[model samples]
Target: MTITKKQITFSQAINDAIQTAMAIDKSVICYGLGVTDPNGIFGSTIGLEEKFGSQRVFDIPASENAVTGVAIGAALDGVRPVVVHQRSDFSLLTLDQMINNAAKWRYMFNGIHSVPITNRLIVGRGWGQGPTHSQNLQALFSHIPGLKVIMPSTTYDVKGLLLSSVFDDDPVIFLEHRWLYNQVGLVPEGDYRIPIGKAKIINKGEDITVVGMSYMTIEALNLIAVLSENKISCELIDLRSIKPIDSKCIIDSVKKTGNLLVLDTACKFGSVASEIITLVVEECFSYLKQSPRRITLPDFPVPTSPALTSNFYPQDLKIMEVISEMLSKKINHQKQERPPISMHDIPGDWFKGPF
Candidate 1:
């Protein structure tokens, strides 16, 4: 089936999703820090207030917990609040409402009440963001029950998942990687909803099953060419929705390939990577030709220095080494072209600021 498409950046797709949702449902209100500011939360929330008016699209105070409580209250009263936190670290302050109230309102009331809210949390590493600002805490949110945790990688998935999260009755944690804002791709025009808890198989192959989450998906995609050159057919799966992982898709792929390599944006310990590995081990241990492996940051805080961070995060060279060991095949790393950027911190030359 052919999809109606237009070339747009990841951030534009997010803006389009919010605009489309608010236009369709008057009850859907977007308000958070920098919503009304000039940057418009890295341009995703731009022009929303002007088009939707102050009552529907406005700004909130710096109090994360208080703003979250207000959003939850509004959601309980039939409002679908889209709250945006500039950084995922800021969201730590609102866990009381997120974990206890927003996530549990529907179940706590025995389906009598539904808190349909979407919290957009931006997470990434770059430009000396340091330990606190650059945290991938999706696992923390995913551990909680009654919440939908989504980490979309593509422009198409981001918009579709955001729309789905906005409409769903349960509270949703929408995590966006800052580096992906400028990445462009063909996205459907409007009103498309990719179902929650479904993983997308990006590339089909036989040698190994490689799963990546958030920005790590992009990283994995970059290695496909080199892997292909070495006759390593990789089946790439993007774990878009973290909370309710698509176990069937992963298990089937692993059963076919008899190998699994997971790449996670979060730390190594007790991460989404670990969770997927455990699922495969429990469901399809007999199908494995070798032990499953994962590539993730060390179980420690992210360093601020570029020199430290360059090696701190999982490098493509390291990934190739692991794949070589996993499949007992060699990958020609010299043939792999490095990313076109002056520094490792910035995603690309198009990147402009600290937002």
Candidate 2:
């Protein structure tokens, strides 16, 4: 049980994961725009070129579609490629290759070949990134078959999950919250892989079950502290992997607690939150003490104005309010003492960014 644990930032953990993968496997290559630069896409790709040389770690042109096609070709040829995109918004250009080619090649060929491609997509809100710069389209990406989609909220997860995604046999859309970049947590040194389709319970309670994805997981953890004071004990489930969500973990928790609240980054009609809630109602409905619920961004474009953006994303107070309604308890409407929110539509002050 005794193992070393050292605190590291989320970005550094990703860097460590890529480095570890490259060190063990010569087939692993890291390439993307500005991947070899000094900032290194928030430092995840810094020093990669120096260690692995230009051929394996150099930058690519602004041609997203062509770059993705090339990576797919390489992966089919047995090279593991990790492609980094500075923003998820622009990765839309590569969706045709991702959805049609990378995601469907193995099945089309009757399982003779697989694309072990890892696309590192930086997602979430920060620094007024606005509609064009910030978006978490996990639901859209996860909808396609033969693709693995994961959103890691912690540094430990950032490292282990990146390693897992790199070694995975199918295309993996690794959606990372840029806001979680500076969050520090203990990570086991060296190579380790968290199983791709599992969920982790960050806080255990019996009154209600709250499943939070990506940054919402962090917000759920924060909200739990306040909910506890009002005698509301909640079970917090962080769905690290989105596509093959750990229904077992969520169902088990909801069965015990009999209450469910799903929180996610986007507001798709049939979103991650909707699917999880539907799963609980279908399977764990008999155990329900309260109706299942969810909180998500409005089904609209993200606002660029910081003033308008403050209310665009979900918040802890929103969770608290939702919980209050579920419990049939009144929330305090009076102006109360609370710290100011520095980052709107984002949780945790973990981002130290130039983006």
Candidate 3:
């Protein structure tokens, strides 16, 4: 049961996934903006072109729609094309190919064709990237029927889930938060594939259930210390895949805890948070002690200034605030020990250089 492991950053895990997949399958290819650049899409695609050669790992232009179309076409021809987007905010331009073409091909064509493509869209923030660049738009793609939507929170999950997405027959939407690029964790040395639709229960408890999606999972982990101090036993679930979210796991956790809190990077309406709440309401309504609460950004444009952004993005403190309010405990605004992480534009100080 033992396995070898090595510590790696989230970005390096992503790079490792691509490298392994390309090495195993001749039909696998990686392309998109900055795939060949020095920064390498925040270093996830670092040195891919040099290692795999430009024919397999290369860059494309700003033609979102065109790039998607070509990738879809290539996928139809029995190639697995990994398309990278610098920012999920700008991926809106490629909806036609994503939603209509790639997402519906198998059903529309009577299962004659399969588009086994992986779309790696990097969600941006910090440095006042503003409304157009800082948005998390996984909800848009998760709504599509044929695509597999994933937002991995750890280095282990990133590599495994990316491997799963690469080998699967349908198109996959792989979301990576900019802040998570520097986060490090243990990753297996060999190939490992986590199931696409499964959710991981991070902590088991009885007081309440907290669901953290994408980067918010990291924040939730940080709030563990504060929650434990208050004797709030939290059952934390990481919703790794958004489309076919592990609803059964979420419902079971809610049933045990009798309270639910969802922390997501997107707005509440029609979001991953809303969808989880809907599942709980439909199947475990009677198990609730309190109404499910969702903590997410306002359904509006992200602020552009550093000062505005400090208050704009909710972090560990905000999660603690929401938890205390939900449990009817006195707000620990001043009493709580502040999180060790500095309040900054990005998560880490390692972001000084490119990527």
Ordered from best to worst lDDT, the candidate numbers read 1, 2, 3
The Cα local distance difference test for each model comes to 0.92, 0.87, 0.87
Q: What is the TM-score of each candidate against the true structure?
A: 0.97, 0.94, 0.95
lDDT of 3 by residue, 149-168 (tens): 99999889999999999999
lDDT by residue for model 1 over 83-183, one digit each (tens)?
99989999999999899898888888899998899999999678888899989999999999998899999999999999999998889999999989999
Candidate order by decreasing TM-score: 1, 3, 2
Q: Give stretches of model 3 more than 4 Å off.
A: 331-343, 352-355
Error of 1 at 250 (Å): 0.5
Specify the poorest-scoring 10-residue window by lDDT in model 1.
Answer: 331-340
Task: Itemize residue pairs with steric clashes in candidate 3.
Answer: none
Residue 135, model 2, lDDT: 84
Give the least accurate 10-residue stretch of model 2, judged by summed lDDT. 345-354
Best by lDDT: 1
* lDDT tens digits, residue span 87-127, model 2: 99888999999998998999999999999999999985856
Query: Model 3 Cα displacement at 132 (Å)?
Result: 1.1
